[model samples]
Target: MGDLGLFGPGSVTWKVHAEPILMVAGLRALLLQTLHPRALAGVVQNSDFRVRPWHRLETTVTYVVTVNYGTTADAEEAGRKVRYIHSRLRGVDPRTGEEFRLDDPDLLRWVHVVEQESFLDVARRSGVKLTDAEADEYYREQLRAAELVGLDPATVPSSRAEVAEYYESMQPELATTRDTVESMLFMAVPPMPFGLGWTPLRGAYTGVAALALSMLPTWARQRYGLPGLAVADPAASMAARILRAGIMPIPRRLIEGPIYKAAMARARAAGHAI
Candidate 1:
């Protein structure tokens, strides 16, 4: 019965995102984002992402979890923090002489759409049960998320068909740049930090990244010059389930972060059994 933030327990956003496989979706989003030259250029110019990739990822995850499960005030504050950062970032196109703001509506919209698409695709492919209507509802709910990062809500696609159409329309604008190729390779095997690069765990992480790559839509795979395997979707889904099951033995408290723990307390106080 307390404030449930931008999206409550009742929202499809909560339902779809509860899956641990969202970890893969995060990588997939990064892969998809690099396909856009402007977006990639903006990041290459303005971000310290290459040197501190894990730090950048943690920042992104913190904002997403706060928005998804924090109280109203907390969520708004998180959004404000992100918007302010975006407003300060600018980059010049490597291919053209043009300069661009990181928060240019066009760039914002592109990032929002690919990101949400990656979430839904990974969730469904990873064995989350969502009806067509529920899938549509998820996108509808994510429009609020799009708005959080400075996108116009009305400009974003709010259903599967619309998203597909949007992708189709944007295809001509998407091509692999040299930076894109480098980014893909970087993601495939991001160097480990703190001397962990020499550990066997680094090989395990590469296997996880491969599953994320396999789950990309055929068109996206094709764009990257990878084989567009008709069977990759199902194969990735199977792999996701196996991976999810393997992690399930870890006690919930051992892995759930402070944000998740706090959110669950709030939900319990509201009388939700979960």
Candidate 2:
């Protein structure tokens, strides 16, 4: 049998992922993701985030939303497109002087784990409650996305404990590199297209960037020479609440974009209430 789109409205993936705070979580994920030098190289070599940051942002968010919310066929097809893109890309590891494919499983796993952990970390800090079991379930269910990117689901971490262990095992491979700094700066303030540098827009972007940075794991922050302090925890929590409140009033149909709209349509067709 094939996969069902949306994993149904009841899937743990939907429960945690449907929240708006995930947009901020995406920034945190970007920061964590660039810490893996090889992965950073893949991005720096292949992506144009520096020149067209919003395009990169939109593409990242679109792929994620597709994998998590698209129909099984659509999700699989999306995965195939990503795999095809990766298959064509190669990069040299600056640290090791070795060449690598973008689709390398180890690198893929690093990308996968950091993205997952970042989303969960930010959502939980922002007050979307998931019991330990629910959190574990969300992790387990998220393996589909990993598989879509050609990762071996069996080798991927699928629970909170497993995720913790996975990160521990990979610590030796993580670091701060030039690419990491560049990627983080781009993610933090991005760049204003067309010279529109209004104070309110710039201030809000900086605030969100600070919030994302504040949510980083201490070791990750220390690697970047950033201080991840205790005070940031409560501050992040308050900011999270504010963000949640801001997005909560908007209808889901308005904020979630096309992939989500299609997913909700599928859910409705299946007689499921979204």
RMSD of each: 1.3, 2.1
How well does each candidate superpose onto the true structure, as a TM-score?
0.96, 0.93
Candidate 2 lDDT trough over 10 residues, lowest sum: 1-10
The TM-score of predicted model 2 comes to 0.93
Clash pairs (backbone) in predicted model 2 = none
Residue-level lDDT tens digits of model 1 in 29-91: 989989999999988898888899888988999888888878888888888888998899898
Q: What's the true lDDT of residue 87 in model 1? A: 95
Scored against the true structure, residue 215 in model 2 reaches a CA lDDT of 81
Shift of residue 271 alpha carbon in model 1, Å: 1.4
Top candidate by TM-score:
1
Error of 1 at 16 (Å): 1.6
